[model samples]
Target: MIKRILLVTRGCAPDEFVPAWRAAMGAAVTAPPDVRPSRVTAGIVLDEVTPEPRHDAVGQEWFDDEEHLSRYESWLASPASAAVDELFGRAVERDATDIVVTGEHVLRGAPWFERRWRDGGEGLKHMALATRAAGLTQAEFFDRWRNRAGLVGAVPIPEVARGQAYLQNHPLPKAAGDWPYDAVNEVYFDDLDDLRERIAWFAENLAGNEDDLVRESWFVAVREEVLWPEATSAGEGLLPGRPGGRGTS
Candidate 1:
C-alpha cells in the first residue's frame, strides 16, 4: 500500500469550512463510497497546532497502489473537485511513501473522534520529519531505530496521550533535488507546555545519540481539530465492530 500526505491550507475561515467538513464527514461514516476517493482504503485529517507557513492541516490517505492513486489524481483534475478545493485551498506540499516501519504506544487512551471540533477535547501533536545520514542503508537505519524504539517509549513524559513512529521507505519528494527527510515521528500531548517540555527533553537526551541515524530533522506541533462519527470514549475505536480495520466502504 502507498500513503499520500497532503498539506492543506484553508482558502476561507474555519466557520466557512465547518458545514462542508461536517457534510463530508457525515457521508464518510454513513456512505463512505459517495464522498471518499474510490481507491482510498483509509484516511484521517490532522490540523496543525503549531504555526507554520503555507499549510494548516495535514491529510493522510492510503491507497492500494499507484494505479489507485493515479485515478484519484485524475479526479482532482475533473470538474467535481471544486467544492473541496474551495474549502481547503490547494495542497501546498505532498508526499507519497511506503510504510517501512511503524510502532505505537497507546498509553492511557486510544485515538478517537467526536464528530465535531467543538465537541472534542483538544490535544497537541508533535511531529518530527527527518532524513537519514549519508552511507546509511535503509536497512541499517531502520534497524537502529527499531533497536532504540523502546528507549524512545521510555522517555518520562507525563503529558503524552499517544505516540507513534513511521519510517518511510524512501526520501520525501523535493523540487530542487535536495531531499532532507526520510521518516516522520509523531507524539500527542494534552497540552502545549507538555509538548514544549518533551522537545527540550529530546534535545538534551537524544539529539546526539540520534545523529548517527538522522542527518536532519524538522519538528512541528498540531492540534486535534475534529473527528467524525463521534464517540463518547477513547476506546470506541475507529469503526464499530472493526477494531483497527481500515475504513473502506
Candidate 2:
C-alpha cells in the first residue's frame, strides 16, 4: 500500500476552510461519480496545532499500489481538478510512501473528531520525520525499530494515547520532490506539556542508545482529523466510559 501525505496552507481562515474542505471530502466519498479513485482505501486530515512555514493542515491517503496512485493522480488532474484547485488554492506540499512498520500499543478512546481539534481539547499530535544513520542497512534499521517499539510500549506514559512508526519503502516520485527522510514517527498526547515530557524521556532513554539509529529528526504538533472507514472499527474501545478509555486528565 502507498500512503500520500499532504501539507496544505489555506488562503482563508479555519472557520471558512474547514467546513468547505469537509463538504468537498463528503462529496468525494458519498456523492455520485465518485471523485475519489477506487484504489483509495483510507485517508485522514490533520490541522497543525503549532504553525510551521506556510502549512496549516496535513492530509493522508492510503492506496492499493503505484498503479492505483497513478490513476488517482490522473483523476485529480482531470475530473476533480477544478474543485480541488478552488478549495485549496495553489500552495500545497505532499509526499508519498509505503508503510514498512507500524505499532499502536495504546489505543485512543474516541475516534478522532474535528471539533476536539478546533476547540483545542484533544491535546497535540506529534509527527516526526527522520533519516537513518549512514552505513545502516534497511534490514538493520527495521530490526532496531522493531526492538525499540517494545520499549516504547513498556514505558507506559499515561499522557500518550496512540503512536505509529513508518519507514519508506523506496524513493518517492519526483512530482512531490525529493524524499528527505526514510522514516516517519507519530504520537498523540493530551497536551503540549505531555508531548514535551515524552520527548525528554525518549532523549534520556531511546536516543542515548549506542545504535545511533536516527540521523535527523523534525517534530511538529498537529490536531488530527481522520477520515476513512477503518476509523470506526478502531474506535470500538474508545467510548468515554470504556475500560482503558481516553483519560480526561
Off by over 4 Å in 2: 9-55, 90-124, 137-140, 150-177, 189-196, 203-211, 229-249
Q: State the displacement of the C-alpha of residue 222, model 1, in Å, after optimal TM-score superposition.
A: 0.8
Query: Candidates' TM-scores?
Result: 0.54, 0.55
lDDT of each: 0.45, 0.46
Worst 10 residues of 1 by lDDT: 37-46
Tens digits of per-residue lDDT, candidate 1, 1-249, equal: 455554444444555443343332222222233334322112223333334533444444444566655665565566665544433332222242223222222222233321222244344566666778788876677666556543543454333423432223333244354433466555655566667676676667665666777887766665543333333553343342232222221
Task: Candidate 2: give the clashing pairs.
Answer: 109-238
> Where's the lowest-lDDT run of ten residues in candidate 2?
239-248
Clashing pairs in 1: 49-222, 49-223
Q: How many clashing pairs does model 2 include? A: 1
User: For residues 23-106, what per-residue lDDT tens digits would candidate 2 score against the true structure?
Assistant: 333223331233343211112233333335234555555556666666666766775456554444422222322233222222
State which candidate has the highest lDDT.
2
